[model samples]
Structures are given as C-alpha cells and as structure tokens.
Target: MRIKAAVLHASPIAKPYAETRPLRIETIELDPPGADEVLVKIAAAGLCHSDLSVINGDRPRQIPMVLGHEASAVVVETGAGVTDLVPGDHVVMSFLPTCGHCLPCAEGRAQLCAPGAAANGAGLLLSGAQRLHCDDGTDAYHHCGVSAFAEYAVISRRSMVKIDRDFPLVEAALFGCAVMTGVGTIVNTCGVRPGQSVAVVGLGGVGLSSVLGAVAAGAERVIALDLSRAKLDLALSLGATDAFLASDPDVVEAVRAATSGGVDHAVEMAGSAPAFELAYKITRRGGTTATAGLANPNARISLAPVHLVGEERVIRGSYMGSCVPARDIPRYIALNQRGRLPVEKLLSGTGPLDEINAAFDLLDQGKVVRHVITF
Candidate 1:
C-alpha cells in the first residue's frame, strides 16, 4: 500500500569528526505483512524521546529508516499463522518482542531476548527483512521494528499486544514505551510495597508515570523532582506526594528528610549523570536506586567504592521498564480503566502527521509530557 511516512536516509557523509544529519520525511511505500507478521493501520503514534535520540544523532540508527516506536493501531491485515488478531482489533506496538525460546525469554527475561537487539537496530522481522519501501523501490527499514511514524506499519505478531477495544488508542500508545518503562520499573523491578518512601527524578513522561506507579503501589510518600514546575505540577496531579526542582541544592537533603534519613527507592529517569548521582546519594542504606533513562554514550557516573560498599545500596539499570509487553500492556490498560493509572494527564499535545518535526521540537524544549500524532 502507498503510505505517507517520514523516511530518514543517509545524507552526504560528514567530516571525520563532525556529525551527519539523516535525511528526513521522504514519503514511502509499505508492503503487506508476510507470514507471522501483521499490517496495521496506525491511528496514533507517540513521539518518544528515543525517536528524538535518533533524529538528533544520540542514537545511531541505520539510514533509510522510519523513526517511531511508541504507537497504537488497528489491525488491518493478518498474515498466515496469525490467528489471535484480525481486522478492527486495537493494539499497541512493542519495540521489544520475545521469540519465547530465546535464552532471555526462556529464562523469564523477555525484555532482553536476543532477537530484541537486532529488532531495535535494523527494525526488521526475525528474518532480517523490511516491509517498507520508497516509490522507486528502495527499501525503508523500520525504526525499532515498529515504525509507527508512518500512517501504516507492518509488524511481527510478537510485537503487537491487543488492548481493550474501548481504550483510547492514542493514550494506549504511550504505554507501548514510556509508561511501560516508568511503571514497570517500580512494579516489576522494585516491587515497591505499601508505605515505602520513593523519590523519582525528572518529572517527564516516564518520571511522572513512576510517580503514579509508586502511588498505585501504595507508597506513603512519592517525591517528584525536575527543573520544570510545569512537570512538577503535572506530577502532583498524578499523585506525587511532594515535588522539588532539580536546581535546588537542598533537593537531596529535603528528600532525605522527608523519607526519614533516606527514601526506600530512588529512580532516575532524566538520563543525566547528575540525576543518577543524586538518586544514588539520596537512597538509604540497603535502598534501591534504579536508572530507567537512556543515557548518552559519553555520559559517565562516578562512585566511591568505600561508600558504596558500606551502604549496601543497590544501583541498577532498567531497560524498557523491564517489561514483557504481551503481559504488561494489557495490565496497564486495565489500571488506566480502573482510574488507578491516569494516563490522560500525561498527554500534552496532539496534531496531524505533517507536524512530526514540530512534535520533536516540543519534546526537545521539554514543553510536553508526551506528544501524539493522530491520523
């Protein structure tokens, strides 16, 4: 089918030490799915930070790629052996999918399935081929295997998770990545218990979702921190027990005081070294500090072994919220339906597909919690 998509191809090579910008928004064609794949009519796609990472060169991706990963759509066609989904079913696209038999999947760590690495890199099916193309017959690879930036996408059955028909597809799209990562960090990784004290740095879409997740897990106090008061306000609306500006020198002290010496859990979602440092320093002895953000390649964090060893504090990284989409996406939707996860408040902007670049601008300025492209 002919589809209008934002295609990024290689530009004239940059000088040895300089950066090269990828070609943007060349319309392309998308082929129907092959066996074990499904063609989707995308209704809405969320502009995730990961997408911005590729556009700005933070994430090195292949050329001639369609850059979008967080998305929700209606199944338009199902390929052979795809029995559970059919036309009209609403679904969310997961950038990471498990083959069930892979080492990670068989070990209950589907998030790290071996195929996931290749899927994220080439955005292709397990067979190592793309289904998108240019009118001139040049193949356009998928970005993260589910390039929802286009009006239509062909994805693997393993990557598509069916959601309630009545769920808001646009909001559900956010769960495909941001919410999954944020909420899953607490619920799955930390197993936060009632009355536990928690602090989340970065109040963006993921941070706020962490706040909501902490609250849902019955944390007695959920502290939200960020440089933007706007985001802090939104965090409060989403159930943050307190909010603080990252610029405040006393931020860590204040958080420590609030949690009575230190918080039970500290989460950093800002992808900044300083934020990770703050998260680590504010956790009490034996407390857990989780890094859910995708940090830059050059970014680094330092720690004193003596202090780290003495404290017994656990510091770890979480990828894609440690989620298995087929199991977690629907559970998130159920939480939203039950009014436990207020996803609607996280949405700050929505517009047409043509405004794709504008959406990226808003994300760069930190002006929106989440932006969606609606058909």
Candidate 2:
C-alpha cells in the first residue's frame, strides 16, 4: 500500500534547528505483514521528544528512517496465526513487546523484552527483512521498531494493544508514550500513595502527565516546575497543586518551602542535567527521585556524595514508565474514559504529515504539549 510518511534521511549530527535539515514527508510503499505481523491504518501519531532525539543524533539511529513511535490506529490486515486481533479493531502501537517466553516477559517485566528491541531496532521484520521502501525502491528504516508516522504501518502483533473502539485515537496515542512514561513513573516506579507530596520537574507533555498521574494517585501536594509560565498554568489546570518557574534561582527553595521540607517524590522529566540535580536535591531524606527524561548522550549530572550519604534518598531511572503496554495502555484508556486522565487539554496541535517540521518547532520552543500528525 502507498502511504504518506515523514522520512529522516540523515542524522542531524548537531542540535536540531528548524532552519536546518528537517524531516521530509514523502510517498512510500509498505509491504504486507508476514506471519505474526499486523498492518495498521494509523489514525493519529504523537510527536515524541525521542523522535527528535534521533533527528538531532542524541539517539543514534539508522538514517532514512520513519521517525515516529507513539501512535493509535485500526487493524487493517493480520498475518497468519494472529487470532486475538482481527481487522477493524482499534489499537495502540507499543514500542516494546512481550514475547511471553523471554526472560523479562516471563518475569512480568515485558517493558524490557529482549526480542522486541532486536526486532524493532534492527529495522527488520521478525523474519529479518525490511517492510518499507521509497517509491524509487530505496530502503526505509523503521524507528523504535514501530514507525507510526506513516498512513499505515506493519508491526508485530506483540507490539499492539487492543483498545476500546470508542476511545479517541488522538488522546489514546499519547498513552502509548508520554502518558505511559509519565504515569508509569508515578504508579509503577514510585508507587506514590495517597497524601504523598510530589514534585514534577519540567511541565511539558510528559511533566504535565506526571502531575495528572500524581493527582490521580491521590497525592496531596503536586508541585510543578518549569521556565514557561504558560505550561505552568496548564499544569495547574491539569491538577498541579502549585507551579514553580525554574528561571528563579530560588526555585528549589520554593519547592522545599511548599512541601514543608522537601517532597516525598521528585520526578525529573526535563531531560536536563540541572533538572536531574534539582530532582535529587529537592527530595526529603528517604524520599525517591525518579528520572524519566531521555537526556542527551554527553549530558552529565553531578551531585554531592555527602548529601546522598546523609539523605539516604533513592534515585531511579525510568524507561517507558516501566510499563507493560498490553496491561497498562488499556488501564490508561479507562482512566481517560472515567475522566481521571485529562488528555484533551494535553493536545496542542494537529495537522497533516507535512507539518511535522512546524510541530517540532513548537516542541523545541515549549509552545505546545504534543503535536499530532494526521495522515
């Protein structure tokens, strides 16, 4: 099938600037799914920072790749042996898949499945061959194992989670990544309980979702920190108990003051070294600091050993919110359906695939939460 997609032909090899090389939308051909695969007609794709990381060379990936990972769609075709999902089913594409027999999956940690990484990262099907190509017959690499930037994508059946048909695909797409990562950090990693005090650094899409997650988990004080006043306002509306502008040098002190001493849980979503430092410092003794951001390769964070030894604080790294998509994506959808997860406000923009560059611009400027590419 012929589909429209944004293809990244070369790695940025430098910081991504809008005036420089940007993802280009072109017509491409998608091969039919092989056995154990499924072809999906993408309804909405969420632009994630990780995709931008690949473009900027922060996350080194093969060139000429289709750069999108978070998406929701309907099943169009299913290859042999796929009986659980059939055509016409709405689904969310998961970057990680559980092979069931893999050590991680069998251990109930599907988020770290090994085969899922090998299949998706190699840009090959489970059978070891490409599934997308340029109209002129050049190869197209798949990003994050599931490139959902195109109108249609062929992915492994293990990489999709069936969702309620009535759920809005646009909002559901965010759950595939942003929401999952943000909320997962709170529930899965931090295990935040009722009346717990939390601080979420960076009020972007991921940070805001963290705030909502903290509130849903019944946190009494959800403090949000960011330089953008606009995002802080949005954070407040989404359930943040208070917002702090990090531009002020006294931001950490202010957060400490708000939480009485220091927050019980601090989540770093800014992906900046400084933010990680602040997350670590702003937690009370015995508190937990969770780093959920995808930082650049050269970024380094430093902390005093005296503080670590004295505070006895726990610092952890979260990947995809430690989520098992098959189990978590559906629960997130239910959260949205029950009015617990406010997702509509998180959507900042929607346009055709050609507007991808513009969407990235908005993201870089911190002007929008998430931009959806509609094919």
Candidate 3:
C-alpha cells in the first residue's frame, strides 16, 4: 500500500533545519506486515527532541529513513499467528522491540533487548527486512523500528502495546516515548517516595512529564529547571512546587538551599552534558541523580571519583526508564485515567504532517512541549 511519511534522506544535516528542510514529506510504498509484525494506521505522532537530534546530527541513523519513533496507531491488520491483537485495537508504538529470548528481555528489561537494538541500528524489522521502498526504488529505513512518522507502518508486535480502545490517540502517542521516559524514570528508576524532594532539569516534553510524575508520586517539592521561562511557567501551572532558571549562576545552589540540602533525586532530561552536570551538582549526599537524556554519544560529563565513594552518590543512566512496556504502559495509563498523571497538560498543540518542519522549528526554539502531528 502507499502512504505519506516524513522521510529524512540523511543524518548529520546542516543546522537551521528550517532552511534545509531535511525531513521531506513524500508518498511511498509500505508493505504489509510480516508474520511477526502488525500493520497500523497512525493517528498522532509526537515531535520529540530525539528525533531532532537525528535531524541536527546529534544522533546518527541509517538515512533515507521515515523519522518518527513516538506515536499512537490503530491496528489495521495483524499478521499470521498473531493472537494478542485484532483490527481496530488502539496501541502506542514502543521504539524498542523485545525479542523475549534476548538476555535483557529475559531479565525483564526489554528496553535493552540486544536484538531490538540490532534491528534499530540496522533500520530493519526484527527479521532484518526493509518494508518501505521509495519512489526511486531505494529502501527507506525504519527509525528505531517504528518509523511512525508515516501515515501507516508495519511494525513488529514487540513494538506495540495494545491500549484501551477509547483512549485518545493523541495522548497515547506521548506515552510511547516522552511519558514513558520521563515518568518512568521517576517512578521506576528512582522509586521516588512521597516525601522525597525532586528536581527535574530541562523543560522539554520529557522534562515536563517528569514534573507531573514527581507531583503524582507525592514529592514534598518538585523543582522545575529550564533555560526557558515559558516552560518553567507551564511547569508551575502543572503542579510544580518551585521553578528555577537553568541559566542562573546560582541555580544549583538555589535548588540545594530550597530543599534544605539538595533534592533527594534529580533527573536530567535536557539531553545535554550541561544539564546532566547541573542535575549532578544539585543532588544531596546519598542522593541519586538519574540521567535519561540521550546526549550525543561523544559527549562526556565530569564526575568526581571521591564523591561516588564518599557521598555514596548514585549517578545512574536510565534507558527507557528501565521500563517493561507490557507492564509500565498500562500502569501509567491507569494513573492518568485517575487524574494523578494528567500528561495531556503537556500538549502544546497539534500540526499537520506537512507542517512538521515548522513544528520542528518551534521545538528547536524550546517553544513547545509536545508537538503532535495529527494525521
């Protein structure tokens, strides 16, 4: 079948993407689902910083790719031997596909499944086949095994989680990446208790989502830090107890003093080395600073060796919030339904697929939280 998708020809493109317009919307051919895959019609997809990373060259990918990993879709067809889902089932696309037999998957950490990573690195399905062919007869890679920027996609069953049929697809799209990474980092990776003081650095979609997670987790105080005032203000409206400007020279000190020492937990979501540095410096002794940011692989942070031993400070890296999609997605959604995690508040607005370039511009300026592309 033929469908429309935002296709990025190559990664590491020249900056000022607005002028270059790297992601070109094109109509292409998408094959049917394989035996281990499912065909989905996308309803909404979120514009995440990770996707921006690829466009700006911060993250590298096999190019000529359909560039979206966070999205919600309805099952249009299921491949042979598939029993868990049928047509019309609403689902969120998980960027990582779990090959249940892999070491990470067997250990209940499907996000790190080796086979999934391999598949993602190669821009192919778990079976190592490319399903999309461009008009020029070139193979288009699947971004992170999802490639959900397209109107339709064929994904491994491992890449999808069936959701309540009535759940709004726009909101469910966030759960695919931003919500899972941010909220899961606080709830699952850190095990934040009700009285713990927490700080979330950066105010992108993932960072703001962490703000909601901390509030819902009953934190004594939630300090929102960002370089943007607009985001801080939005965070305040969404239950943040305090807000700080990351650009302030005294920001780290302010966070520490406000918490009477330092926050028990600090989350770095800005995907920058500087943001991670701030998160680390503001953590109280014996506290944990969890980093979920996908910084450029070459970027490095300065960590004092003595602090690790003397202060017993835990500087842990959180990938996919150490989540088991089959378990955490439903749990988070239940909380959202109960009004404890109103992630919808993070939606800045929606745009059409053709306007994705403009949406990326807004996102690059730190002007929007979650920009949804409504199909």
Candidate 4:
C-alpha cells in the first residue's frame, strides 16, 4: 500500500524548519503487517519535543526514517497469531514495543524491555522487519517501531494498547508519550503523596502534564517552572500553586523559600543539563530529583556526590514515566474521563499533515503545547 508519510533523509537540520522543510512529505510504500503485527490507520499524531530533538539532531536516528512515535489509530487489520485485538479497535501506539518474555517485561518494567530498546535503536520492528520503502527502492526506518506520521502504519502488536472506542482519538495521542511520561513520573516514579511539595521544571506538554498529575495526586504545592511566561500562566491555571520562570537567576531561591526549604520532589522535563541542575537544586534534603527528559546524547550534568551522601538525595532517571503501558495507559485514561486529568487543556490546536512543517515551527518556537496532526 502506498501511504502519505513524512520522511527525514538527514538530520542536524538547521532551524526555521518551515523553510528548511526537513521532513519530506512523500508517497511511500507500506508493507502488510507480519506475524504479531497489525495495520493501523492513524487518527492523530502529536508534535513533541522528542520529535524536535530528532529534527535538530539532538537524538539522531537512522536516516530515511519516518519519524513519529506518539499517535492514536484505528486497527484496520490484524496479522497472523494476533488474537487479542480486532479490526476497528481504537488504540494508542507505544513508542517501545515490549516483548512479554524480556527480562524487563517479566519484571513489570516494560519501559526497559531489552528487545524493544534494541529494535528501536536499529529502526526495525519487534519482528526485525522493515515495512517502509521509498519509490527508489530505498528502505525507510521506523521511528521507535511506530513511524506514526503517516496515513497508515504497520506496527507490532506489542506497540499498541487498545482503548475505549469512544475516547477522543486526538486526545488519546497524548497518552502515548506526554501524559504517560508526565503523570507516570509523578505517580509511578516519584509516588508523590498528598500534601507533599513537588516542583516540575519545563512547561511543555509533558511538564504541564506533570503539573496536572501533581495536583491530582493531592500535592499541597505544585510548583511549575519554564522559560516561557505563557506556559507558566497555563500551568498556574492547571492547579499549580506557584509558577516561576526558569530563566530567573533567583528562581531556585524563590522556589525554596516558598516551599519552606525546598520541594520534596523536583522533576526535570526540559532535556537539558541546566534544567536538570535546577531540578536537583530545588530538591529538599533527603528528597528525590527525577529526570524524564531525553536530552542530547552528549549532554552532561555536573553533580556533587557529597550532596547525595550528606543530604541523602536520590537522583533517578525515568523513561516513559517508568510505566507499564498496558496497565498505566488505561489507568491514566480513566483519570482523564473522571475530569481529574483534564488533558484536553493541553491541546494547542490541530492541523492537517500538509501543514506539518509549520506545526513543527510552532513547537520549536514554544508557541504551542500539544499540536496534533490529524490524518
């Protein structure tokens, strides 16, 4: 089948992506789903910073790859040995395809599945197959086994989680990444309890989702920080007790002073050394500093081991919010349905795939939160 998809031929592309047009919208060949795979028609795909990271070469992947990992889709067909799902089922794609027998999967840590990680790094499906090809017979790589920025995709069954048919697909796209990472970091990784003070650095879709997670978890103080005042205001409206500009030199002091020393937990979602450092500095003694941001591979943070020993500080890395998608996606969706998550507020707007470059420009400029490219 031929599908309209976005293909990146090279990376480290210069900015003003609207003009550079890094992602070429081309009609490409999509193969049928193989065993343990399914064909899905994409309904919505979100423009995330992680995708931006690839565009700017922060997180490089194989060239000639179709780059989209967060999306919601409808099952069009199921391949051999796939019995759990059927055609017409609404589902959300998980960036990592978890093989149930893997060590991490057996340990209930699907986010760390070894096979999934290897497959993602190699730009292949869990089945070790390449399903996308170009007109010139060039093979295109899958982005985290999803490659969702297209009209349709053939994905491993392990890469999708079935959702209620009625859940809005546009909103469902967020659960795949932003909601899972943001809310999962607080609820699953940090286990933030009621009345605890929490600070979240960065105010993108994921960071703001953390704000919602903190408030929903009953955090007495949900502090939000970012370079954009607009995002700060948005966070404040989403139940954050205080909002501060991350660029403020005294931001750490202000947060510490307001929280009566510091917050119990501080999460870095900005994917930068400076943001991680800020999160670490705002953590109270004996507190936890967690980072879920996927920073540049070369990015490094400076930390004092003395603080870890003397202050008893705990620093942890969170991937996919340390969530098991099969269990957590529905749990988070339930929260959304109950009106507690209110993830709808995060939608900046929607656009067609033809305007994808412009949409990316909006995301790169910090002008939008979660912009969905509707198919």
Off by over 4 Å in 2: 13-21, 125-127
lDDT over C-alpha atoms for residue 1 of model 4: 99
Model 2 scores worst on lDDT over the 10 consecutive residues at: 13-22
In model 4, the runs with Cα more than 4 Å from the true position are none
Q: List, residue by residue over 1-375, the lDDT tens digit for candidate 1.
A: 788887777533332211233435566777778988999999888887777777666677777788788899999999999999989999998878667888888888778989877776666776576898887777777887888888888888988899889888889899988899999999888889999988999877888889989998999989888999989888888888888888998988888887788889999999889999998888888899998888777899998877778888788788878888888888988888999998888898899877777666778789888989888
Clashing pairs in 4: none
Model 4 TM-score is 0.99
Residue 148, model 1: lDDT of 86
Residues 85-109, candidate 3: write the lDDT tens digits. Answer: 9999999988889899988899888
Compared with the true structure, model 3 gives a TM-score of 0.98
RMSD of each: 3.1, 1.6, 1.0, 0.6
Query: Model 2, residue 100: what's the lDDT?
Result: 76
For each candidate, what is the lDDT?
0.84, 0.86, 0.91, 0.95
Clashing pairs in 2: 120-145
Candidate 2 local lDDT, 195-236, one digit each (tens)? 999999987778888998999999999988898999999998
TM-score, per-candidate, Cα-based: 0.95, 0.96, 0.98, 0.99
Q: Report the lDDT tens digits of candidate 4 across residue range 1-375.
A: 999999999898987888999999999999999999999999999999989999899998898999999999999999999999999999999999999998899999999999999999999999999999999999999999999999999999999999999999999999999999999999999999999999999999999999999999999999999999999999999999999999999998999999989999999999999999999999999999999998999999999999999999999899999999999999999999999999999999999888898899999899999999999
Error of 1 at 65 (Å): 1.1
Q: Quote the lDDT for 38 in model 3.
A: 94
Q: What is the lDDT of candidate 4?
A: 0.95
